[model samples]
Target: MALLEVHDLVVEFPTRRGVLTAVDEISLHIDEGEVLGVVGESGAGKSMTGNAIIGLLEPPGRIARGEILLDGRRIDNLPYDQMRTIRGKEIGAIFQDPLTSLNPLYTVGEQLVETIQTHTDMTPTQARARALELLIEVGIPAPERRVDQYPHQFSGGMRQRVVIALALCVNPRLIVADEPTTALDVSIQAQIIALLKRLCSEHGTAVMLVTHDMGVIAETADRVAVMYAGRIAEVGPVKQVVKRARHPYTHGLMGSIPVIGHDADRLTQIEGAMPRLTDIPTGCAFNPRCPQATDRCLRDRPEPMPTEDGQVACWLFEKEAAHV
Candidate 1:
């Protein structure tokens, strides 16, 4: 069974004007020790999906429909207290800004020990030793001494490493990492990504990595899900989606990536901006920006249909499937 399953999830917000759907019916899964990259433009609901899975959606924003299951057990309906316990124990979370995720007031050791103790039956001494080991595992130098330092003491990259350590302290089965490298230097981003890949592989931890950087996804993920305007445009193995995208939106996203040796006057770009949640158009949310959009695309939303090796939600694919 898939380690993590998100089925037909619809995240909505109750606004004074009307209800706004931030995430439409989207589904995906991740297996143990695999990285599933969720990539899209900003405001594409990548982070929102991660937050929903980790039970961290702010007030007014809620899962209006569908379900989230971890290890074949429904967690979307679990009470706040139960879900709180599950957060650090069953599922870990790493956010874009390490500074925001880590408490500046507490020593790194204190935080890691607390998280470890909460989920495991380890004594304080054992938890502290584990915390130090985790810091070393994540490549923090001299973890024995660094463990007692505050968040402010570490460099940006080192602080992120600490956040990653805290996330893994409880030995969670899955992790929801939302833009975990966005706040770091370009050089540091690669190191952090490598660290996550190595540690998760060693521990057999599944990852839901949410980001806007296609390069990061290409490097770290086994599979990729391309989201656009709150819906999944395409999903498949990382190699296929990166090299042979089917949906126009996914194609545009891949094209927008700057190739190292290629010379161009300007990078390829999609014509229109993502729709605002309050003003999402009828039918396929991507129709307004899709170059291959048809009348059917503007009038009727398409469900995910099988493609060469993955799935794409597009009327064009549906018609092609019909002929087959």
Candidate 2:
């Protein structure tokens, strides 16, 4: 069975003007040890999906419909206290900024030991040893000394490694990593990506990696889900989606990425911006920006239809296939 499942999930916000749907009927899954990348521009609801899964959605924004399941059991309806127990123990989260995720007041060792103790019956000594081992596991040098230091003492990359260690304190079955590498430079980003991939392979931990950077997705994710204006435009294996995207939105996204051997002087650029929540297009949310959009695309929203690799929500999949 899939490690995590999200079925027809909808996240909405109650506004003074009216209710705004931030995530519209999104559905996807991730298997054990698989990294499912949710990629899109800002406001595409990728991070919102992760937050919903992790039960961290800001107040006033809520799951209006559908369900989230983990290990074949429904988790969306789980009581707050019960879900709290499950979070660090069963599902971990790594965010974009390590600074916000880590507490500055406490030593890194204190935080890790607390988490370990919370989920296990280990003694303080045991927990501290475990914490040190975790720091070393995450590639923190001088874990002996660094463990006692506050979050501020570490570099951006090293602090992110600490966050990774904290997330894996109990060896959670899955992790919802939301833009985990955006705060770092290209080299640091690659290092974190490698670390995540290595962890998944070693520990069989599934990942829901949400990001706007296609480059990260290409490197880290096994499957790719392309979202536009809160809806999934396409989802498939990383290789297929990256090389033979079926939906125009996915195609545009793939085209925008720089290729190693390609001689193109300019990267492909999508013509328009993502639509605002207040003014999403009537049919496909991407119709306004999609160059191949047709009358049907502008008039009727398409649900996910089967593609060779996975599924795509587009009326032009036929033409796309022909082009392919």
Candidate 3:
């Protein structure tokens, strides 16, 4: 069975304007030791999906309907304190900015030790040793010295590595990484991606990687889910989704990625912006931005139907003959 399953999740915000649906009946899963990349442009609900899974939805936002399961057990409905325990023990989260996950008041070792001690039964001395090991494992220079330093002491890249160390300290079954490499430079981003892939592979941990960069998803994810305005446009293996995108939105996204050797006058651009939650378009949320959208696309929403190798939520692929 998949390690994490998000079934028809609906996250909404009660606002003065009206109820805004941030996540609209989106469902996906991450298998054991596999990385499922959730990719989209801003306002596509990728980060919201990740936040919902880790139970970090902002106060005003709440799960209006649906469920999130971890290892066949429902976690979305658990009490805050109960979910908190599960979040640390069964699932870990890595955010785009490392500082948000780290405390400036605490030494790197202290924070690591605290999380370790909170989730596990390790002694203070034992937790410290584990923290040191984690620092070394994440490639922090001078693990002994750096462990005693504050979060501000590390460079952006090193601080990210430290956050990674904390996330993995408990060896949780899954990690929800929301734009985990965004703040770092290109080289450091590659390193962090490689580190996440290698570590997850080595330790048999599943990951839900949420990012707007299709390039990063192409590198680190085993499977890709392309989200569009709070819904999944397409979901399949990385190569399939990247090379043979079925949904127009997915195709537009793939075409926008510049290939190093292939020259083009300019990258493909999807003309329209994703709709705001309060003003999502009818039928297909991406219809306005989809170049190949039809009359049916503007009036009839297409549920995810089977593709040759995956699933796509587009009327163009509604029939078997449409499979490429």
Clashing pairs in 2: none
Candidate 1 local distance difference test against the native:
0.91
Instruction: Provide the overall lDDT of each model, using Cα atoms, as 2-decimal numbers.
Output: 0.91, 0.91, 0.89
Cα lDDT tens digits, model 3, 205-280, are: 9899999899999888899999988888899999999988888888888888899989799998889788888777
- Candidate 1 lDDT at 42 equals 95
Per-residue lDDT of candidate 2, residues 1-324 (tens digit): 998999999999999999999999999999988999999999999999999999889989999999999999999988899999999888999999986779999999999999999999999999999999999899999999999999998889999999999999999999999999998988889999999889877999999999999888888889999999999989999999988888888888888888898899999999979999999989888888889888998999988877767889998775554443
- Model 3: how far is 196 from its true place, Å? 0.9
Quote the positional error of residue 176 for candidate 1 in Å: 0.4
Clash count for each candidate, listed in order shown: 0, 0, 0
TM-score of each: 0.97, 0.97, 0.97
lDDT per residue, candidate 1, 1-324, as tens digits?
A: 998899999999999999988898989998988999999999998999999999999989999999999989999999999999999888999999986788889999999999998888999999999998899889988988998899999999999999999898888999999999999999999999999998899999999999999999999999999998889989999999999888889889988999999998899998979999888889888988888888988899889887767788888788665654
- Between candidates 1 and 3, the one scoring higher on lDDT is 1
